[model samples]
Target: MTARETPESIVVVLGTRPEIIKFAPVIRECLARDVPFTLVHTGQHYSRELDRVFFEQLDLPAPDVHLDVGSDSHGRQTAAMLEGIEDVLVDVEPDVVLVQGDTNSTLAGALAAAKLNVDVGHVEAGLRSFDREMPEETNRVVVDHVAEYLFTPTEETRLYLEREGVAGQVVVTGNTVVDAVYQYADVAAEKSTVLDDLELSPGEFCLLTAHRAENVDHPDRFRSLLAGVAQFADLTGHEVVYPIHPRAQSRLDEFGVDVPDEIRVIDPLDFLDFLRLESTAALAFTDSGGVQEECCILGTPCVTLRYTTERPETVYVGANCLAGLDPADVVAAGSLMLGKQPDWTIPFGDGRAAERILDALTEVETDTDTAAATVTPTETTATETLQ
Candidate 1:
């Protein structure tokens, strides 16, 4: 009934590669501290490159449970995840369910845990694009309201929660992505040969990724984006390398959208390989929230392909610009961003978020246990005196 009631166990649920990357530090901290926790994979991103390869590359333990809920319509995917996650919650009966980021898995994990009367901990919580048209915004809002612990990534986000009157206990733990980037940047540089393999020189090739449902599901927008990439390449004379998402590839075939010769289309890369490419890129053009944050930390200028973004810090700091879905606009934004200096400060954490999160969870449990122990004798004494 109170924040002091400690959870006996924790279940960490994730579905996509970004979630895996962001949560990897938390998972590692749990293992290192000998915390009682289990990893559950909802299989939101099912491809080997997108999913399993990250575990191998990151040296993370394989998930104890995999829901295998692959791609589908938003409603159907959420429903499948809810059903599968509900089953796991019932069996495990964890005192707390931990979910990161705004995804279907985050929403489902929170909803199921709340329904089961289990405590919910939402990492990277209180993010808002203020556009209900985007499913991620809706997921974030819902999860924040239900979570017992809101581990927000920034002070701005904590204020967002306060303004919303969120009942959850909010803590500004900073974004764990910062931790992931600091931990892996050097590893990627030492281990990855992506630049050599792709025959790319540092800061000479533009890296691109666009696979948001809003962009790929609409034919005109998708075509316009492709045309814009072509125009950008033509204007800058820099090769545009796109590691296509499976969804985008399907849409390309379905809509008969042609990729330009200057744009090299390739399969997705593992986390290390992609980080190596991203860190060395001339500029990144993407519709991914994760990429926007990655570029900001890596000091690379970025052109966001979406109309709006939840991560406004990157834009405010002048490390990123929103280019929407127009070809001419995308080219212009890319050209403008290329000339800007990468002299922005990192707005995220100090790369110690995981340790802080583990400390917070441990403190909560200890306080809860101490409170329970103190209350039992008081109630017992009162009862004995009355008798």
Candidate 2:
């Protein structure tokens, strides 16, 4: 390693748009403090929609390394990410390897770093859906167990951690999802031409995104969800902006679900543009967990198509709803939320999540004994109900 390669600390890993948005604030904190860091892109969602432009729009440094572990089945994708992340950890030896949320990349990276004693920090930790069938719930649970530092976005997540008997350093930093929105929304609002180009205006359209594995893994469910949204948009005479994921797009072609001429299926927007549109939209319909949170933060009510969510606070608070695969339910939920005034005090955190997480890491590294005392071995409950 050269002198430039030998940074004292590195905030190590992220993949997917959610990870990018959440961790960008952490990276900003590191840079502001002159703390050394290196970013590792695991390439779980290799499409430009999930990668590339998000980095550019967020003003994040180009990743020092990219694994390019593209799309595949859950098992194969994760195994590939494990090998790829392990290789990078061996090469980089970052003092801290931080991962965000519950993607396969997050679980694989956290496990790899923990096994190597690399002091892994799990951002957006302690989230649970109590559903084992959902791979993401499993990933989040496992990542939490392996993480040396658990940065929760809400008091609810913190309580979930304590209930699981995880006594590791728990800090209630606000959700970085909110942080990303605050940081990027203004810039995206000003710069994006998506609204004008699509002839969309706020309150006259509904934003749609559906790319979750459970929803996309089955052709019938995928068809129903898309058809439901398209049909509802037509019946209501509301413009629908559907930014289909590459995976979902492939499935659409495979299943012969032609993109409705009336439905605007376009390339994915960067974070800023997406946020800007989401902010001004009448409502959002999607299977994306981050989109659900972003919509809540932006005060645009959402109808989450999935049956369950790790972020249930949104549902409980009525900022979102679990409309499942049924088109009727989705239509009703969309209409209901569209007409209702959105309650914006989301149960998630204030925008100070990254700062609190960094402060905790600083304390943990400096006071080894106190950090060690905080660690007590204990059994953990499983999150297998969401699927």
Candidate 3:
């Protein structure tokens, strides 16, 4: 293999807290390698409380451009972001624009970049739930087709792209969330006092995070999930700890859903605090895709509340199970995962995913024109080459 020049400049676009979390490693990689990059936050899922503290906690540089296109209907939200992102791409004219996961922000960023002739490098690319009811599923498909560089997390995902015949160069770079988890697990443990504060012990609590529209937007579904989770905790004899998103909490209140006394509801936690809980918890029930990846990586058994998941690798490895909204099934799935040994093979890659991704961009590809090489993390400046 030979070395090609690193792209002259890169633009990163993200919106939600998960995006912020998952993209931190890539942003840090840019910093480490002295890559000239710019950060553009669409603010699609912005909250002052979350945005300020999250960046501080991750120790990431602030967004160079904040397109403060906050919450709205899906059409309005994505359209505004698409418009704003196009403007930014026009101004910056970056060589490539980086987007992560399946969100409106991801779709907007990819579309904007593709329209402007800027190459799009999509992280966590080629995921599919096969259920088009999900806005995320649509976003994933569109972004994958539009992207020039598709960085997948697994061989399975790479194969999916192959089957779809996407024109993008696909590389199985592993999930960036795994990289984030490995990077922050020890740091969270050392710095967070969540267990002490919650009066919880290792393997004694069951965490719950239900914020997805499919689960929480409908009153009956929301109520059913709450009851089902309560029953699951009761069956397991584990305390149910719910760190509710403020938006979901309001929806619950609006729906007039009764909370079971067994489930303890609390305000949201920062990344470190939540990581502390998730790492120690006996089990977790969530509608969050990111939580599924994180719990699986942390060796904490998880039951996904959603009907379908883009990260099915977690389920394939026995680290997670899908228990979509039946009280009986929810309890059964939780019970099944509770006593199992955490012997599941880690499917994500070595912790050096960021290094390999950078290497692929800067180093020449193998004869297959697919770059899935791993590299050791060494001091490398912008002009450094992979040899």
Candidate 4:
């Protein structure tokens, strides 16, 4: 092990709603440990609903650096974020940067840090949809290859890292989503009046959240998914409550795809409100990977609108099923899931992922002091050549 150099200083980078929810635990852990960390917001999700609401709802501290780099083409967005993040890394000079999931923001953070010869700790690493077409898959693959420490949610994902021969210390730190759910479920239950506000009763509604680029970018596919969801809602006798994502809503408007009357479209909810609904809903239908994990943990059966999912544990455990965008298939999958009980063993983790992630980070010796587990600082990550 290399001798410890300096006290750990971390830059936590985030841009979207899920990143905020998922990263809250690690931030809270940093507070508890008195680890000096800076929060950097790339502003990838520009809307207040999609970004700021999460920080406020989660009671997370505001970002120390705000890049304000909004949406664009994937190439443009990623390049902008990379440049902005590089500036922050230069200014902060953090020992490591922490990025979560497979968003462009995640990739940018890892890339910026690796370019500067900084260690990167990736949360929820090694997630693979195995579909090259999905931008997320590319982001995940790239970030995993560059990151020094890969904190995966499950042993299955750890094996994925090993199989890929990724040059990183892969640790199976149960997902921080589980930690967030366990920590906030009770709080959400007590504080959230979302059901009452929406005039919804438990088991009376199905939650729908479809914001994947492939699903919403095309008018035909988006409309078909909604039609299928509408059918699923009718079949299950549960009204679909869709807290529409901005991207999906924009496509609906631009493409002039009329949403079915059976599906009630509403504004996006804060994490607490959404979590409350997710916990109480009879069923959930969505294309979101994070929602699948959340519903699985909250005991809500989910019907995935997409064909492929990185988090196949939900399907393996009977908590979720892929219904695709076909109207009939969506209805069938929803019906099948509705018949089953939400008793699948929590496949993500034991609700201590934040602690575990930090523990692994702490184990990473900085400058030549022997730690049982130490992440060797990469002068140039293997992914750099690919970049």
Top lDDT: which candidate number? 4
Best by TM-score: 3
**lDDT for position 57 in model 4:** 76
Writing each residue's lDDT as its tens digit, candidate 2 over 1-387 gives 001222377756887878888899999988887778888888887874447788888888888888888888888988888888888888877888899999988988888888888887888889887878888999999889878778777767878998998745776676887777767777887799888888887789998998877888788898788777877787788888888788888888887777666578888777777887888888789888888888877778889898888888788777888888887887777777875576345566556667666667664332323322232112210111000
Question: Can you give the lDDT of residue 147 in candidate 4?
Answer: 93
User: Each prediction's Cα RMSD?
Assistant: 10.6, 7.3, 5.3, 7.6
Per-model TM-score on C-alpha atoms: 0.92, 0.89, 0.93, 0.92
Q: Give a tens-digit lDDT track for model 1, residues 203-318.
A: 89999999988899899999888889889999889999999998999999999888889899999899999999988898999999999988888878999998999998789878
User: What digit string (tens of lDDT, one per residue) describes model 4 on residues 28-112?
Assistant: 9999888899999999988854577688778888899988888899999999999999998898889989999999999999999
Off by over 4 Å in 4: 1-6, 363-387
lDDT of 2 at 45: 75
- State the local distance difference test value for candidate 3: 0.84
lDDT of each: 0.85, 0.78, 0.84, 0.85
lDDT tens readout by residue for model 3, 1-387 = 345578888999999899999999888988899888989999987686678788998999999999999878889999999999998888888988999999899999999899888999999898889989888889999999999888888777888999999998887787888778878888898999999998999988999999888778899999889888999877768899999987689898898888898799988889999999988888999999899988877888999987889888889888899998998888988998986666666666656667666766675453323334332222321112111
The TM-score-based order of candidates, best leading, equals 3, 4, 1, 2
Task: Tell me how far candidate 2 lies from the true structure as C-alpha RMSD in angstroms.
Answer: 7.3
Give per-residue lDDT, candidate 2, residue 33: 74
